[model samples]
Target: MLTLAAGASAPSVATQLVGSGLIGLREGLETGIVVMILVAFLVKSDRRDALKWVWLGVAAAVAMVAIIFVAIHFGTSTVTGLAAELISGLASLVAVVIVTAMILWMRKAAASISGHLRAGLSKALAVGPFAVASMAFFAVGREGVETALLLVGYAENTAGSIWPLVGLLLGIAVAAALTVALYFGAVRINFAAFFRYTGVFLVVVAAGILAYGVRALQIAGWLPGGSNLAFDVSAHFDTSTWYGTVLQGIFNFRPDPTVLQVVAWAVYLVVVLTLFLRPLPAKPGPERAPLPEPSNIPAS
Candidate 1:
């Protein structure tokens, strides 16, 4: 049993667990969707022969991500004290940026991703197998790296060690199963609505992460005024309480946060939430195969 001193509390284990799970679910679903789209396009086009190459590319991407994850794990373990804090702060900031971009890009791209992928498939088919394989690699590889970055950031901040990893693994497993069902037409989801809600949730999560990044920087002495907190609610609200765990789990909530942390959190939430909730722009989708290039249609 770990002991906490006066006005000192370690991170909640449950919070880390659920937070990591959400990240895993979101990231896993995106990766699954990309692969599903590629596979579906090939099948519909009667290009079943190219499926092997696609799978190969996906495998290669997975292997690359696995290697990177392992390397980071070992490397972070060796880092300690101020160095670890500095690295974590920077990494968390990067993760927030990537996640924010992903959420916004998905908002715009979700509507046209299928069409764009199909068009890309058509072009890839015109090229060689290498191009097809490379296309799949790039598509899947991107999501894989993004997923890894999210996990890495979470891992860096977690004090409960393996609890976060367990949640992430469970979420990913659930996501994989969901993807398979969706691809086989056993399940149908309103992806637009799904993305909208999840995007909002992720924006909130990113704000929390960004604030935590500032906290980390302050702890590392990379930023001044670590002790200059805006308020100290710890006297009245104990983080060991049930509600505290809930808040901390969902939003990384702290009782007493530095002025910089509060400012960063507030500005991020207001700016990003407003931008994310704005209406999506209208646009033409992937040119629609040029209307079959009508010249000679068998001259019936």
Candidate 2:
């Protein structure tokens, strides 16, 4: 999408807008889930005071992302050719690491994430507002940083940075609106199902990012075997064409790839898919023991 949009003869302004909007949808959905979890904890615990902390965390994360963008934009201009390539390549590599960790963690912890968040909230509440804010900051900050890095990588690899960013923003807006609706019971979605499917989709996307990062490193001379073209399909398909543009934007498809790029893409898919497809352990059911009354326990 980014590549096609970045191309000289890709599409009209409206097409770019729609493409970016879809990208935003995916990005926003991911962020929305985290926000939903945070808000749910606040409402469940009756900790309206803690809500500010959540917003603080979100603001801090956004600020950090902006800083990154400014730094990259200015830094790229200051550095010479090789140096600039190295910086961008290294950044992409770092993004791959962050994205990979997030995927694996989510895969392993998806079943119990709610419980973990609840426990963290309990601890945060015990420590007062500052601690609550810090907790929220860290939680959301993790996701924000990952999103920022991924977006940076995407922007660097593809053409037309602003359009992709626009898409991302639109996605976030839609996701946020949907989340708010869900919170108020105005909307209903099978969250478990949604996460499950999206999780799979994310894994595929991460694989493409990993491949892209490796290619960037090759271009920067940080990796070897860049000279050899893995395969050429450009004779049959021009990436600048309408169908090609759509595929390029959504899947990061390139007609020409280096040997290392192909290998990296394949390895990523194999490893991630193997782990993703592994059957999860069955969750234990809730205990049947009688609950203690709220009045019976001493107040903190």
Off by over 4 Å in 1: 1-14, 284-300
**Runs in model 2 lying further than 4 Å from the true structure:** 1-23, 73-80, 286-300
Extract clashing residue pairs from model 1: none
Q: After superposition, how far is residue 105 of candidate 2 from its true place, in Å?
A: 1.0
Best by TM-score: 1
Query: RMSD in angstroms, candidate 2?
Result: 5.3
User: How high is the CA lDDT of each candidate model?
Assistant: 0.75, 0.65
Query: Tens digit of lDDT per residue, candidate 1, span 1-300?
Result: 012223334456666668878878877877888888788777766789999989988888988887877676666566889887887788889888987887777766766666677678778878978888888888888877777776776556445267667778888898898888887667766666666777787788788878888999999999987999999988888667778866776677788999999999999999988888898665565422221111211111
| lDDT per residue (tens digit) for residues 88-134 in model 2 | 77776787778668766766665655556667778888888777777
TM-scores for the candidates: 0.86, 0.83
Candidate 1 has its poorest 10 consecutive residues by lDDT at: 291-300
